[model samples]
Target chain A: MRFYGYFRSSSAYRCRIAFNLKGLAPEVVTVNLRDKAHRDDAFLAMNPQGLVPVLDTGTARLTQSLAIIEWLDETQAGARLLPDDATARAEVRAFAQIIACEVHPLQNLRVLNYIKAHHGQDQDGAGAWCRHWIAEGLAACEAIAAAQDHRGAFAFGDRPGLADICLVPQMFSADRFGLATDAYPRLRAIRAACEALPAFAEAHPARQPDAQ
Target chain B: MRFYGYFRSSSAYRCRIAFNLKGLAPEVVTVNLRDKAHRDDAFLAMNPQGLVPVLDTGTARLTQSLAIIEWLDETQAGARLLPDDATARAEVRAFAQIIACEVHPLQNLRVLNYIKAHHGQDQDGAGAWCRHWIAEGLAACEAIAAAQDHRGAFAFGDRPGLADICLVPQMFSADRFGLATDAYPRLRAIRAACEALPAFAEAHPARQPDAQ
Candidate 1:
């Protein structure tokens, strides 16, 4: 298997965490987003969306970080990324989706570039745009986390799973934009727990081989 | 089960299609987005994100259309919203995520309102913003559909599943924005096939009871 990713992409960061969690060492290939390598013809042919974090398993080529992570969870027998209970799984998925579908998409590079190019937002303006969505999303995540029955070291229980994989990268993005996360104490504590794990520590954007 | 949704919301449309496919009639509770009902205190308490398509099953209150659909697929046995095979399920999920995580979020009302309120965009400007993202996304979906080894009546195979559920709502949205989708012949054909089904047909935004 080969994994295509950029160092700082939140989506790629997700795949990295999942790979490490599953204890699978697929060959790593970096697609430099900064140099527009992701938009190259070869990359686009592999993924029509021209997005990073395309995992090729020889049998199948997959895109979308969440989809890839779920695929890993299903195919790999070890570590259960999703819980056995149906309702608990829904809670975890909903928590992850809050970050994936709501927050991260709005602050990604393409959207930010669109705002800058068409909406007349400068660098500072784009930062503000990113911070606004991140803050809105994290506050909601905090509320949800606070409401959870089991508030251990991780997002769900004592074990770190899919929600933790998504939350960690999002917090990284939040820190990048200089957003204040003091309000989300539970989320910050979960981030701290996740960061302490070797699986998550190795997957950090700064720890990646292609980090600037 | 009770569903909270707006008729034209793409997220809610996905849930409506899933419910119809599963042959379950959950009582519909309309949260009118046009009137800002989704942002009401009660709705936010139920779903912190303040987004629609929240399904309360008396056991679990699920948010996120994809997560809700997956839960329905898991709990309801008769109809298979996702395939049995792992790789096939990943393919379907990746296809759906292209629209759900990418296209639909960009053109939703809140984002459009943000552009208008902050960027000085009027209706026309917002429409252009919607069209731009829709066109770019659909072109990729068309490429994906065309590249599929088995080009059946739907997005994945002969049966209309998660990807098809996502595609139809997106096509409706594309038409709403006056974007030309002629370039996406494969996607349009799949949309035609999906629209012909009673499940997809009844789930159309115009066909909903809450539709204005």
Candidate 2:
């Protein structure tokens, strides 16, 4: 197995956490997004979407971090990324999507770049944009986590599964933007729990081989 | 089961299609998004995200269309939204996320509203914005569908599965934006096949109970 990723992409960070949890060590290849290396023909051939965290299973190449994480959960035996019951699984997935779909997309580098170019936003404006969206999403996630039967050490339960895999990276992103997270105590606690786990600790962007 | 959805919400349309495929007749409740009914305290109590297509299963509330569809696929066993194989599931999911995550978020009513309010983009600018992102995402989907092993009557194989579920609504969005679809022959063919089915036909935004 092989993985192509950049150090700071939250999507790639989610996959890294999943890989760590599943105990599958694939060969790591870094595609430097800062240098626009992902736009090269070689990488484009691997993933036409030109996104990070493309997993090459030798037989097929996988794109989309959430999809790749789900694939890993299904293929690997140990450490279930989702709960057994269908409802529980939906809860976990919805929590993850709160970050993956709602938060991360709004604050992605590409989106921020678009804002700067098209909306005439400057660096500070981009940072504020990231904060607004991230805070909105994390607030909603906090509400879900604080809901009566859902709170635990992780997003869903004791295990740091898919939601945790998604949360830790977004926390990293929130911190990068210097956003205040005091509004989401439950989310803060969840992030603290996840960071204590080696799987999440090791997946931090600064710990990656390609980090500047 | 009760589903709170607006007629024109593509996310809700995806769930409507899945419910049709699974043969589950959940009570349909309309939440008028245009009138800001989703922001009401009662509806917000059900889904804090204030998004349409919140499925109240009598025991739990579910949000996010893809997650809801997966829940339907897992809990009810009549029809398979995802393929049996893990690799195949990843392919379908990655294809779906190309729309759900990449395309839809950029063009959703909320995002377009943000563009209007913050960037001062008018209705025409918003339409152009949607067209740009939709075309980029659809082009990628077209490439994926045109891939050697992926092309068929649907997004994958001969089955109208999850990828097809996601593709059909996106096709609706594309057409609504007046974006040209001639570039994607395989996507157009797949859309034609999906539209021929009752599941897709009945799930159209125009066919909804609350459609204007």
Candidate 3:
């Protein structure tokens, strides 16, 4: 198995955490997003979306971080990334999607670039855009976590799973964008618990070999 | 089971198609999005994210359209929304997330509102923003579909599963934004095939009771 990813990408970070949690070591290939390597024809052939991290499971190349993580959970043996029950699984997935879909996309590099290029946004303007979406989305996630009937050490349960995997990366992104996360106390608590785990700590962007 | 949704929400439309495909009709409750009904305290109590398309499954209230659809696929007795093989399921989900995470969220009402309020975009500017992301995202979807080996009538296979469920509503949004479908032959063909089904046809935003 091989993983194509960039160190600082939240999506790639999510997949890295999932890989560590599942105790699988796929060979890493750094597709340098800073250099626009993701836009090259070779990378586009592998994933038309031109995004990371793409997991090549020897037979097939998978794109989209959440899909790759879910694939790992389904095929890998070490840890169960999702719950067994259907309803509980839905709740966990919903929490994850709040970050994946609602939060992350709005503040994506491409989106920021678009705003800067077309909307005349400078670094400060782009920063505000990132912070606004991150703060709002994290607030919602915190509310859901606080409202959960059986909140434990992690987002969903005692063990860190999909929700925690997604949360940790977004929290990292929040810090990168200079978004103060004090408003999301529940999310902060979950992030602290997750960061304490070696699986998450090892997957941090700063720890990756590709980190700048 | 009670489903809280608005007619025009693409997320809700995806769930409606999933429900139709699953042959499960939960009680429908319209949460009018235009009037800021989703922001009401009662609705936020149910789903703190304040998004439409919350499925109350008697057991738990589920948010995030993809999560709700997956839950329905798991618990309901009907057509399978995901393929059995792990690899195949990942491919299907990756295709769906291309729209769900990448495309839909960029054009979400809240995001558009933010851009307009902050970036000084008029109606036309917002339309351009919508068109840019929609076109780019769908081009990726089209490329993926066109490149797939053993292509069927739909996005994945003969069965219109999760990928097609997501593709159709995104096509609807594309049309709403006046983006021409001619540029995406593969996606257009998939959308044509999906729209022929009663499940997809009946779930159209115009067919819903609350559609204005």
Clash pairs, model 2 backbone: none
- If ranked by lDDT, best first, what sequence of candidates would result? 3, 1, 2
- Report the lDDT of model 2 for residue A46: 82
Which ranking of candidates, highest DockQ first? 3, 1, 2
Q: For every model in order, what is the number of clashing pairs?
A: 0, 0, 0
Q: Pick the candidate with the highest lDDT.
A: 3
RMSD of 3: 0.9
DockQ of the candidate models in sequence? 0.84, 0.79, 0.91
TM-score per prediction, in order, is 0.99, 0.97, 0.99
Give the per-residue Cα lDDT of candidate 3 at B162: 94
The 10-residue segment with the lowest total lDDT in model 1 chain B: B71-80
lDDT of each: 0.92, 0.88, 0.93
lDDT (Cα, tens digit) per residue for candidate 3, span A1-212: 99999999999999999999999889999999989999999999999889998999999999998899999998989999999988889999999999999999988899999999999999999999999999888989999898867758899889999999999989988999999998888888889999999999999999999999
Judged by lDDT relative to the true structure, which candidate is superior, 1 or 2? 1
Please tell me how candidate 2 rates in CAPRI terms. medium
Stretches off by above 4 angstroms in model 2 are none
lDDT of 2 by residue, B101-212 (tens): 8888888888888878878789988898889888988888988889857446888888788998889899899999999899999999999999999988998999887889
Off by over 4 Å in 1: none
Q: What lDDT is reached at residue B49 by model 1?
A: 89
Error of 1 at B87 (Å): 0.6
